[model samples]
Target: MADELELLRHANPVPVDGPHFGDGPLDHHAERHLDRLLRERPTISAPSPPRRRTRLAWGLAATAVVAALALALLFTGQTTAPAVAAPRPLLVQADSTPVPLRTLAERAGAAAADGAPKLRKGTHVQTWSMGMSDDKPPITLPEERIVRWHADDSHTEIVVATDPRHPGRPVLGGDGELVADGHVLSRQTYPPSWSDAPPQSPPPTDLGRLRAYLQEAEYSRTALNTGELLHAVATLLDTWTLGARESAALAQLLADTEGLRPAGQVTDRLGRRGQAYVYDGTGSRQMLIMDPATGDVLGLETTFTEAEPEYGVKAGDVMSYSAWMR
Candidate 1:
């Protein structure tokens, strides 16, 4: 290989452009000595190409590129790669026997009004969201397992039975502060998930403050505007963040409402499904829709009423709603 490379190097060696350095005869001892050194030293095998060789090399390169492109097209059928099919919207393997939305709403309503414990316990196979965790990223669990919804006057808790991956119990308590009451209890919080900092901002202007203000106001002294109430509801919906209980409750509410549109249902980062409602309070022109059943506040849709398309408010379009999930 070394001998072959040497031969190739000699054959391909580039010629000097300038006059030869050894044209004249050696005149002195110093010149003779330098000449001798030059003669003794082997010439470096220059890889530089002559003009004809350079042109030939470029031609070959261009030909190779064209051939490669043709081969690629032969295999792929296009110069550009094919567009990946939009990931099929994840089709959750729903319960073979799903508890009706109305059933859930009735139970939630009863629980809210009478503080009666109305429970719906079943097994849920779901891809858990990271927002549901305190330390780890969201992971998908592929198995049927027992899970229970415990509802009472003030709160509802979802408890997932022990599994090998997460042995003991994984519980989401909603009766105010999530109390881990299950054996080997693992608790999940709402928007508070994985957050270590305290909530520092002022309470939301429309929901927290306005609700308080309305409650404090004397109903006899001033007649409340239904328009304003609708507005407040829209604000509440906008500010809402679905945790374990909040999201479920919000979904129930949207489903229960007689005329509300529940289409753009969304799951949150925490994997709760709910929707948003937009309306001009005190008018026939109201827009009520659910976000995608995957993420919080993803988008919305209007109710059955045929409203102008111009009124459609979409995800990534940030217009404050008149109310939100409390």
Candidate 2:
């Protein structure tokens, strides 16, 4: 028993004594993806484990944890990726008038009345996140993931390390090497499932129910902060492609939210246009990108609005960004 407990002692990659204790790797998306798969229908959703700090790192620790210490072994061997700085902020139109979240919510509610789409259960997403640590330098990694669910409650997932912004350029690989050709890191299928949880089960479409659902999904309390709400949004979309009523309800919920504000229009990293919404948190800033016409979420970006010298994160540096593609 002592030996077994000793083995467990080394399992914690983010030790409390470590510089980045309590921080999570870039919204904890990778682990969320993994747990989703293990639950029978693997889809990227809210992370189930210890809820991380608001100033998310997305560092080497999560990579190792998600890969079951494959990167951990490499990390101990000092084979981690090269240090890369954060990317530039998404370009927002400086002159555009601010649009209130309520207005968009109303537009979405109207659109839903016309005819709501019963979206499938899955995710097609693109993400760029800066992974940082006290020991290793920050590197911005880009990848795309697609997850689909079948009638049997089975699901499929595929992750490719490529960025559409600069195709054919040398991209960073998991082992911290640069590969000229982007390749698939993983392709997997999860057989029919563990439990019918909040995310795997279709999300509730009613406004009141949806709020409760999100709170439950993220293991959060009733009064979630700006960042946590946005996290819930990303995780929810990761699990289900919201239909008309759900989208409308979500828009209204966000509309009623207090801290969210419109920051004008901007082009996302995917080159598509979107309206940007900003939420300022304790030590970071989150920009939510949405399709104006449909009220569909396009993407979300988190930036280090304040510098953390301990982790080598700078103010204005992008901590992570994820795009929920249609």
Candidate 3:
């Protein structure tokens, strides 16, 4: 009985490395009580016929009492502490002009009725990317790329690396060659079928058919959501030229989408005025600029809405942007 009591006395009730909900360490009062219980050995009266059994029973009772008291302290500590709240969304500035999203959509739809430009035989796109540089102070550097894809899937690309801070300075190619004189740094041509074929057919012109096409064509492999749909539509416009009917359908689809908010009128990087619509997705914010006069997509930009310290990206930093024209 004494040996058992000694073993119980040394047993630690509080965990040293586990989840603790309490705001502070174990209660001082509880610790003192535990110490006292372990130190003050109970004295039993003179042995009876079942003296051994009596002592064993007494030791077991003491162990149970100590365990109950320890549990009470732990639970009390947890219940008294307050819970932590979730983080709030970061704030971002929007254009001052306030226009209803549906109103802009209607105007865009009307403009689309005017007819779209003739479809060309190839896809041409220009893109700009801003990213962290290796230098001290870690300023974002800008790079530009132009992609041209033939109707048969053969493609060519020209890349230019420029320092945004020194726009007038000449940029050099990787091979120690001067590329600032409107010369391509490096160019490669891929044979037909070297890559996946571009959308050979234009997107559907009806709202229902377009919605279904967008869902299956773009987001079928991944879980679909309103934000993903908006992003897919914006990406589609970047590559595929939309006619009046198709553009009107797209405008209507966006107007009916939940959580699509108007960000008012803003000038794109190309100095073209357009209505902006914003969609908040997981860890990012996508802004689509639509030309209200011609019902055309003028530009698209995505910015980070959450801080990703691992990537050294702060909230509100523009990740990438593209301005496109047929």
| Candidate 2 lDDT over residue span 1-326, tens digit each | 12211221122222224332221222344444445543453353432332122232455544543464345345556443332335687878989877788888888888888664665687767777776677655777776666666678766666666665564444565454544434666566666664667776788777788888888888876667667889988888877778777778888888888888899998776666778999899988899987676677878998888888887777888888887754
The RMSD of every model to the true structure, in order and in angstroms, is 32.1, 12.5, 30.7
- Tens digits of per-residue lDDT, candidate 1, 201-311, equal 212223344344333332223533544443333333322233323333544544544444322333322233444343433223344333332112222221222332333
Any runs in candidate 1 off by more than 4 Å, and if so which? Answer: 1-230, 237-240, 254-284, 292-326
For candidate 2, give the lDDT. 0.66
**Top-scoring candidate (TM-score):** 2
Off by over 4 Å in 3: 1-96, 130-167, 170-186, 193-200, 219-223
User: What order do you get sorting by lDDT, best first?
Assistant: 2, 3, 1
For each predicted model, how many residue pairs clash, with residues at least 3 apart or on different chains? Answer: 36, 6, 0
On the 0 to 100 scale, the lDDT of residue 28 in model 2 is: 48
lDDT of candidate 2 at residue 67, scale 0 to 100: 60
Clashing pairs in 3: none
Candidate-wise lDDT, in order: 0.28, 0.66, 0.49
Give the poorly placed runs of model 2, Cα more than 4 Å off.
1-85
As a TM-score, model 3 comes out at 0.57
